[model samples]
Target: MRIGLLTEGGYPYAAGEPGLWCERLVRGLGQHQFDLYAVGGSGIPRPLPPNARVARTADLGGSDSGPTARNLLERTAFGDRRAARRAYGRRERRRFVEALHRLAVGVCGEHTAGTGEAETGAELGIAFAEGLYALAELARERGGLPGALRSDDAVRTLESACRAPGARRGAAAAGLPDHLAFVEHLERTLRPLSLDWYAEDALGAADLCHAAAGGTTALPGLLAKRFFGTPLLVTEYGVQLRSHYLSAAGADRSAPLRTLLAALHGRLAAEVYGQAALLTPGNAHTRRWQEKCGADRARIRTVHPGMAADRFAEVGEDEESGDPATLVWVGRVEPAKDLIALLHAFAEIRALQPDARLRIVAVPVRDPGSGAYLAHIKGLAAQLFPDEAAGAHAVGENPVTFEELGGPEAPTLEDTYASGAVVVLSSVVEGFPTSLVEAMFCARATVSTDVGAVVEIIGGTGLVVPPRNPRALADACLALLREPERRHRLGAAARARALELFTVEQNLAAFRGIYLELLSHAPVRHRPGDGVPFAHPAEAHVPGSWAPKAAAGTGAPDA
Candidate 1:
């Protein structure tokens, strides 16, 4: 069976989040053909698996489509236009306006009648779905939705919807500029409507459309399902809506824009979840988010993100190694990781155990802001350990050492995890805690703040404390450091759990079954020359009682 693997800012790119996993899946299932549809990346060179090939790639991040002439006659033509397109008809224009209004109302907040009778949440959901499809259908027919969505009419419609009674206060207070900005952003976000991937020769030809992430990536699958009856299987290792929320929370945008974008994302997420044939959340933490966003519990499955466990196999098997008094933190150094709090906790740990050491093994994230955050963390470390040297030093000399992953002391990821007895995660905000899981794979006892899926991933195998609690974090690390036996036990348990649930093999197996399961239930779209049943069919040639019988004197099978 052919699978359309859809991705956004990931996959088929060496630096993408799901690149490794997608590559692994495609390589492992060599029997199946995979067509990759990627969006928003450098299109940087990356090797493709033998069974997989690129179908189409679009740069949603502002790549030019080149110049084209716009003829007035073609632009003025109606639905029968063969060149450009006509403005929406009176009826179609009203339908489009009404749909957008309904969607906006659903997004901002539901309204009640003068009698206090309000539309049900289900009704609002219907409105959002209807509005989304209406716009999509309009784009299909008019061929100018990109411009239409960015027009003054769309902005005015959105503003009016926000000003309507029962709209959320934040949205109701939006200014003209906010509306204009939002409309422009919305047009880009909804660009999947203008894509030509829905034809029978494209995504329509696939047995199933597997979205690597939700939000933007899943939009194409939604369109595919809408246009060609293709089933959509959405897999989200890190929930896209949640990431948007975090980024919006941190962004220097206006309140109105934030509120409007949040509402839009909420409505879109609900629609996607409602339409998906199945929703696979990488962890239970993400599953809860999906459930809250209206994904049916029956359709939700927890598929843990797979990691290559073999790289850490030797480290995990060596139970007696690692410094008993050292605490390690390994990950990208960013403010979200809350290294400041980690430094504070380490200060407390040092006071309790004079010989205890902390190794902050980290690498900067792609964002330039992380460099400043890393410097701040370094300054905090200096102030916390004022007696220690101000700069880098040989390993084991400084009580608190800051180093990158590829430094002489830690040449590889496995080596970095092996450098300490207790791995620590002190982030106040987290999603799946990939670093914690890596620690587990290294068979290292973890002392992590309870955030995101850390508790779920640890599964009682390691210590979990409340986020931003320095005393708790310090105490947990101290306990693990003081008691070697408990640390060893937790490490062994964590390793077992990681191997059982979070390995590449497990992930491949899950997707392998999911692909077959979705395909088994999907409606088969028969094409030309498929042949009639039992007429020169391969099944008829099988050695079974139902096989065609041979004539008494002839060697050939009777028809």
Candidate 2:
């Protein structure tokens, strides 16, 4: 099978969870050929597997007239520099405006007041999808939308939509600057519409389109399905709409601008969910988000993110290893981790058990603020528990020790998990809780805050406490620490569960089956002069069981 793997910002080009997961999926499914379509990736992509190759990439960074725009035209315009000079005629400009106007109206939250939510949602969904596909068709015919989206007409359309009656209160307050900002953002978000990858030679040839995420990353997949009838399989570990909300909360944008952008993403997410053949969420928590966003319950499946268990196998089997008095917290140090609360909880733990130690091992994170957050966490630790050890030989070092994963003290992930009896996760916010899963793989007892998929992933194998509750967190950790047999039992059960559900093998198996299932139901797509193995069998044309027998006996050719 030929798979079109669509990704954005990461995958192949950047090193992150999305990239790592895509790389692993491509590598694991070596039997199938993969064509990677990436957007806005930086740095040299890691080595491609033998069965995979980068088919196309679009850089969404920089402004409309910047180098990136020129590069996009050069690459997607089939090497025709004259394509950049191609402008929409009067009629073409009108078509573009109409399509864009519908899109703006769809996203600007204009609906009949007092209407039921279901009716309003259905109306908005239809409008959004109609406008979205119309714009796609326009872009496909015009070669690209970068120029058109940056035109004055596009800004006018958006401004009119925002100021229209019944539009969102926030959107109605948008000014000229807000319109310009939204136009710029929309251009980048819809950049995939202009990519030439939808031709018969590119995504059109794929047996299945696997989107690495939702939102803008899935735009290519959506187009492929729309243009070529290729089935789209959308997998999201971190919900893109959720990320958009979190990012908008932190951005310095104006209220009207943020509202407009949020509406755009929300409508896009709903469209993507509605159109996808299957939506694979990494956990139940993500599955719920998909369902809430209009994804069909029957089409939704929960596929847990896979992890390599071999790295921690030895530590898991040998339960006797690690300090019984030590607690380990492993993951990127950030505000979301709520390390301050963990420090306070640890203080309580220290008062009860003076020998109980906390080994806070920081892993690498992409955020620039991580360094500052780690420094802040260190400062708090110092203030909370002043080191009584003035000399090197003082009874034992402070109960809390901060170390990086690759440092001499920690050395490796396996060693870090093996160095503690109870693994702790204090994240007030989380996604799939990769670190907790790793701890489970190491067969270590865990006490995780109730966030993200913690409760679902733990499944009663480990102790769970409400997030940001220092007393509750401390109590759970202490309970596990005091009962050696209970900790060992829970650790063993966790290891069993992780091996069964969270291993790389299980993840690959689930996708392998899902790929075949989706392809089996999809119609065979063939292009002119393309030799597609069984494009149209005799049964497809003749119908019924007798057709196969008749063809066999008469030596008749397939239709």
Candidate 3:
């Protein structure tokens, strides 16, 4: 079956996020065809992954515009249902306005779990948002609407509603400033609905549309289901809701602005989750976020992102000599990785195993975060070992080697893994920690901090330590370093587990089954003027069982 793989800022971009996984899936399942849809700027110049082939690529980076073209962005006047007058009624508008007021300006009503009622102002705000989207969709179908949906009238209506006498306590306190902030944010947030890609000609052809990520990537999926009857599957490796909340936690926007944006995103998540046929999260953490965003538990599945399994065969062989003393830290040099802690831990390691070498590999990116962190770590290394260095230790000659995985010394990622006795991921914050998994594929015992899905992914294959505890990290590394037999044993076990669960073969097999299962159950709906359908389209006129049997028996002249 054909799959419409939708993505944003990645996939088929030559340098897209989930680039390798997409390629792996495509290559692994050669029987199925894939169409890649990516949205990002045009700076991507990397070569495609070996397995990922695209029948066609739909780019959403830049738009071609002329003077007469509509900008697609317009003012939103909440309660302006003039464009879609009938979607909302008197009672809905009143309830929505009251709830929105409580949500925006007042203390949000209590969100009493399991009850559909909006006891808190927050719940009320979300209710009001539902009315707004409902009205917008109605307007799109009917070609116009006002009040809680779209238009200058809706904005005016929203302003009046928030300022209404019976509104929630906080909403009743809203001024022109609060009103304007909400309106400004509303315009920016609702930009997804204004795109033309939602039409029949764009997203209708696919048997199923699978969004590789959420947020903007899922926007087209929403449209496809709206304009066409296309089914949608939204998979998020990192919960977009959590990211938004973190990003907006300390913004300069007003309380109402924050509330409105939150409500809008909350409402969007709700809508996406509700509309999606399936919701796949990469880890349990992200899965919980999906549930909190109102995703039905039955519809949610945890599909760990696939990683390359073939690259590690050499080191993973039954007989390979990997150092028990040498520790490898591979990833872009960022503060989040807590390299300082790693250095301090390395100092502890040096006290016991004097010859133990700690290699800090950097993956080149345009950002100076890597270079700056490398320099800072180099300075710390100097401070740590003040006795050694002068003409003896230059940049390249230092014991704490600052090598790039995609550059000289360790030319490739696989080579870097092969060089290390053990892989160390000392990250304080991580989403999926792909490098750790890659190391696992190479049959290298890892020492990742107890962050993200490290503990879950490790599953007793490698040693894990708490974040920012250099001493504890040192102890764990020392334990593995001291026991060469244990390291080899753990490495073998980790390699076995990675191949069983995290490979492209397993991912492809699971998805291939799901695709067939979804299609088999879904009734085939043929678009008008699309030629003869494979399904039986002929009308029936049978009087009884005997008549039907008689008709079925004769194909020539009318019996």
Point to the candidate with the largest TM-score. Answer: 2
Indicate the residue-level lDDT of 270 in model 1.
86
- Model 2 spans > 4 angstroms off: 62-86, 110-115, 389-395, 535-559
Which scores greater on TM-score, model 1 or model 2?
A: 2
**TM-score on alpha carbons, each prediction:** 0.87, 0.90, 0.76
Off by over 4 Å in 3: 27-35, 41-132, 135-188, 248-260, 368-370, 389-397, 535-559
| Local distance difference test scores for all models | 0.79, 0.85, 0.67
Predicted candidate 1: what Cα RMSD to the true structure? 5.9
Which residue pairs come into collision in candidate 1?
A: none
For candidate 3, lDDT tens digit of each residue in 1-559?
A: 4567786555666553476666666677655556666654244434544333443344444221211112222323223345434555676555444443433332222244555544553455455445545544644553433334334433555566666554544545556555555554554444445444454444666667888778767866777776676888988888776777766232655565455456556766777887899988888878878898778999988888876678778777843665556899888787888999999999999888877888888877777545777788889988886655454543333456777767778888778888878899998887788887888888888998998888878899999989999999999999888888899889888888888878777777777776776667566877654433432222222333554455457542331
User: Number of the top candidate by lDDT?
Assistant: 2
Q: Rank the candidates by TM-score, best first.
A: 2, 1, 3
Instruction: Sort all candidates by lDDT, best to worst.
Output: 2, 1, 3
**Residue 306 in candidate 2, Cα distance off native in Å:** 1.5
The alpha-carbon lDDT assigned to residue 114 of candidate 1 equals 62
lDDT of 1 by residue, 501-535 (tens): 99888988898788878877888665443233243
Pairs that collide, model 2: none
User: Lowest summed-lDDT stretch of 10 residues in model 2?
Assistant: 76-85
